[model samples]
Target: MALSPQDLHRIAQSRGWRDGRVEVFDTASGKVTVKGLRATRHAARYHLLNGVARLLGLPFLQAAPMPGGRQAQQTEVARLRALHGVGARVPEVLHVDEDHFVMRWLGQDHLGDVIQSHHPQAAALWREAGDALVRLHAAGQYLSQGFARNMIVDGAPAAPAWPG
Candidate 1:
């Protein structure tokens, strides 16, 4: 089910990205996450660092925004849609507005959590996650931030759809 902005605000936690807000809300259907980029002082720091890097002929900080002012929400949606169309297990996008977007929450657990569990199912989970990554890459989907925590594991035999 698609979540409204009001629903997202209701379940918002105090914690979120340094330059944005991320809230996970639970509903009768499942969890949904609302991610939005917020104006923050951190942007200045990033820009400064990027400028210094350019002057020094060094690589820009990974945390710095991409060149040409890429819009995070739109980029993410495009990537998700591409991945999904190629049969990559990925969360279905419910809504989008400028800097904000909502997507179905895969689950509480991610590959990071499962790998640390040491449970018997950990191996299977890892295999599934790996397979999903392979599929995504094979489809030419290159995730700039490829972290295990970004891949969700819902304890189902099949891999849970991924959430960014």
Candidate 2:
């Protein structure tokens, strides 16, 4: 079933999710993370950054604003599919709507967290992450957010794997 905004709100509330752009809830199949996209939600911030970059004559620093609702959602879905197709460890998209999409929950820990906590497998994890990125780039796919915080650590010390 296509989930509307109201339905998402209800599900989030029922599951005691805090108010945020992303919510994670469990279903019979598995846990999924649903993200609501608002094209204009961060317009002011993007505009401000763009203005600053333009004033500094740094066109390359200009940030692209989110596209319209449907387009943004579509782009996200397409990117996820593309990345997955390239054998990149990314969330598997399960459902979508004009304003929201749901993906399988990879894990709870971020790569940054694991590295900061000095996990025993940190070095191996880093190596695996680097390998994954090389593979992704070799496939001509790139991640807009390649920061450690944006990378999720699926399995760590016990069963180290590439960050998703």
Candidate 3:
């Protein structure tokens, strides 16, 4: 059916980013992403479970919930997590669960809009974006997939990363 923040918190072990019906709280706040398989029942859960396990300092799937199912994906997610902060420009990993994560919500703007927009500041934004990319690479982390449809605008900054 659908996944909820509470569900994710139940089985999640760390923090991360999400793809299915997610809500970006502010400049840096992710709740469900920190939770994993229990976080939701969507395609991303499979990858999230794999990619963010190590990012959130949680054990890989083999050492976690399902044991040996999809070890390869798990490895990749671990890579992403290990590279969580290569430079000082990486998104702050908020938390991670079985297959979910939460992170600092970078401004909810996509590359295309940032580049193709008619805004006068688009040019400057483009330059900043270049720097952002370098900084991200320096963080030593690599996202297997994240573009366009990956972002969501949730207005100005809000509450803490997650309620305790």
Candidate 4:
């Protein structure tokens, strides 16, 4: 069944999310992350950042802030599809509405958590993340935010199969 923004908000509230824009919940199909694009609290921060970048003559450093509402929802849906089409490890979009969309939950842990926890495979994971970024760039696709906190790390590390 398709989920609407109201349904998602109800679920999020039940899960202890007061006013978050994103919420992760489980369904019969599987776990999913629902994002509501109706908040613009960070718009001013992006505007300031972009203004600074423009003044510095660094157009490439400027990014479009989340437009909020329907436009933001559509843009996010399109970007997710485009990125997934080019073999990027983005979440698969499951459902979309006028102001909200649901995607398959990739994982709960971010790359930043792995680094902070000093995971044994942190270095290898970091290298893999770099390789993924290079691959994405080679495909002519870029992320608005590519920080470690935004990169989700799924599953446990596998032992190398190389023969010594």
- Clashes per candidate (backbone, < 3 Å): 0, 0, 29, 0
Candidate 4 global CA lDDT score:
0.76
lDDT of 1 by residue, 90-149 (tens): 888877665566788777777776676555577887887778777777867777566788
lDDT of 2 by residue, 1-164 (tens): 34456555555454332247788876655677888765545578888999999999998999866765677778789999889877788998877755677888898888887887778777787787888888888889988778788889885643345343
Candidate 3: regions farther than 4 A off:
1-21, 25-84, 134-164
Give the Å error, residue 112, model 4: 0.5
Candidate lDDT (C-alpha), each: 0.66, 0.74, 0.44, 0.76
Deviating ranges (above 4 Å) for candidate 1: 1-20, 38-70, 156-164
Model 2's lDDT to the true fold?
A: 0.74
Query: What is the Cα-based lDDT of residue 13 in candidate 2?
Result: 51
Per-candidate RMSD, Å: 6.5, 5.3, 13.4, 5.5
* lDDT, residue 89, model 1: 74
Instruction: Tell me model 3's lDDT, rounded to 2 decimals.
Output: 0.44
lDDT tens readout by residue for model 4, 1-164: 45556656555455333257788787766788877667544578888999999999998999766676677778778999999888788998878755567898888778987777777878898999999898899989988688889999888443242122
lDDT winner between candidates 1 and 2: 2
Q: Encode model 3's per-residue lDDT on 36-146: one tens digit a residue.
A: 333222454566766777677765442333333235335535654566535433355555434444555456555555444444554565566556656666756454444
Top lDDT model: 4
Alpha carbon deviation, residue 58, candidate 4 (Å):
6.2
